[model samples]
Target: MEKQELFKIGDVAKMFHISVGSLRHYEKFGLLKPEYTDQETGYRYYSTRQFECLNTIRYLRVLDMPLDQIAEFLRNRDVKKIQEMLQQQKKRVVMKQNELQIIEKKIENRLQQLQDTLSSELDTVRIIQTGPRRITWIRNKLRPKSYLDLETSIRQLEKQQENTVVFPGKVGIGITKERLLKKQYETYDIVFLVLDQEDNYNGIVEELPNETSVAIRFCGSHADAPVYYAKLANFILAHKLTITGFSKEITMIDYGITNDITKFVTEIQIPVAAI
Candidate 1:
């Protein structure tokens, strides 16, 4: 009788391009066992017959199948079981693709916003027509004397939201129509998260109708907002426009985004109408 050839553990691992530790792990999980173990040396060896099982293990692992599931299938595999597993994994892959698509869109929007902010002409007030915008907001007396106060207010607003995933560049502070008329620029009456058209939120959502607005982008945050508010007020007065709604003040770039104070940019948009 002819003796069959067997490869050592290291050689088998090298053939499969996997670490020897991985083969040991598969043995520990009872997923695969070596063809033979030398009693005196306790060294492992694999016969060529075991290669088919190792190849199947590698194939399923590439599909991200859990080790326990792979072991179960290997124990009792058939065409029907493989077909079912493939369908389930396909569903998981599709779901992951959808999640990636949403993430891609958010990255694209953030990139555009940063580019627009970098190119914006600071301190120049302009009257522009804006489309209707939707926001999920919380009404609070947020006169931020410090960064902590502002952070607390944002946390409170997030708590009120059903969807707690707040994205950057979507948050804004608003001054009431009366507050703007009174020149109370430092005090904000509401904090809001502007919603994309696809966003679904179960909270205090409001739609600000399409209207003309006096807008100005500046190199500052809420702390530097009072000066820009004064500028917008002057622009509105000079143009004979009346303040019609809450002022939307959004920080395009701020400490939350970057450490550099020079990169900070904030924009204030006040809805208006011709008198």
Candidate 2:
């Protein structure tokens, strides 16, 4: 009788430079099945043909494919099916890549702020008589994490605003009347949407009455916000403007979750009278 050629688990592991224990675990997980088991010693023997299968399994697993999916692919060995599954994985990876890119850009922005613009100018303030106009906005719970998730929400709000209101500006901005308060784990309610009140054409905004607001540009880290707020309070006092309604901040720039330091840029709005 001719002896059949076979490779022991250790030999295969050595060939692949993987530990024997890792191979045993993979077998236990149904990722690799031995060609035959010795009855007396209960030793597992793999066919040389299974080398490619093991390599493929490890590759797919590295791609973060679930164990069940990996088993299915190994069993079926269908190229088209594998390609389809890989395509779905690619999309998930791409979404993650976009998130990472946003984070990196934000880090760069913060670094620039830290080096050049954080505390050079004091008593820096601006006042603009924002004309009455129409805008479509979305109000929601906002916080540090919310900015990280801004793209999806911004896309949703933009679609909704375009569907519901006649907006002229090509830009989308978040506007709200909340007092930019920082409460740990507190729900931040702010509006995210399209603000185009200059154009006469309006579908939803035209329904509201005209009101005035005092606006200030805040270009600093979060620590600088209180100072800006104090300045806003001072501006109101100096101008003798009447405080009528809730003050708001229109988010023109967003540094989404690159880091958790003192870096945030927003346009602070204070509602005031013409006194």
**Candidate with maximal lDDT:** 1
TM-score of each: 0.87, 0.43
RMSD of 1: 3.0
Regions of candidate 1 where Cα sits further than 4 Å from its true position: 1-5, 35-44, 145-147, 160-164
Model 2 vs. true fold: TM = 0.43
lDDT of 2 by residue, 1-275 (tens): 11168888778889887888878888899998888778798877888788899899778877988888888887788879999989988998898897677567655644664544344343455554655544555556554333444455456555533233322112233223344222122233544333333223233442324556666656543234445666777777788876665445443334442253444445555566767
lDDT of 1: 0.85
Give the Å shift of residue 176 in candidate 1: 0.7
Global CA lDDT computed for model 2: 0.58
Cα error, residue 202 of model 1, in Å, equals 4.7
- Give Cα-based local distance difference scores for all models: 0.85, 0.58
* Candidate 2: segments with Cα more than 4 A from true spot: 1-14, 17-22, 34-47, 98-232, 239-275
Worst 10 residues of 1 by lDDT: 156-165
- Predicted candidate 1 versus true structure: per-residue lDDT over 81-159, tens digit per residue: 9998888888998998987887787788889988988999998998889888888777888776434566776776677
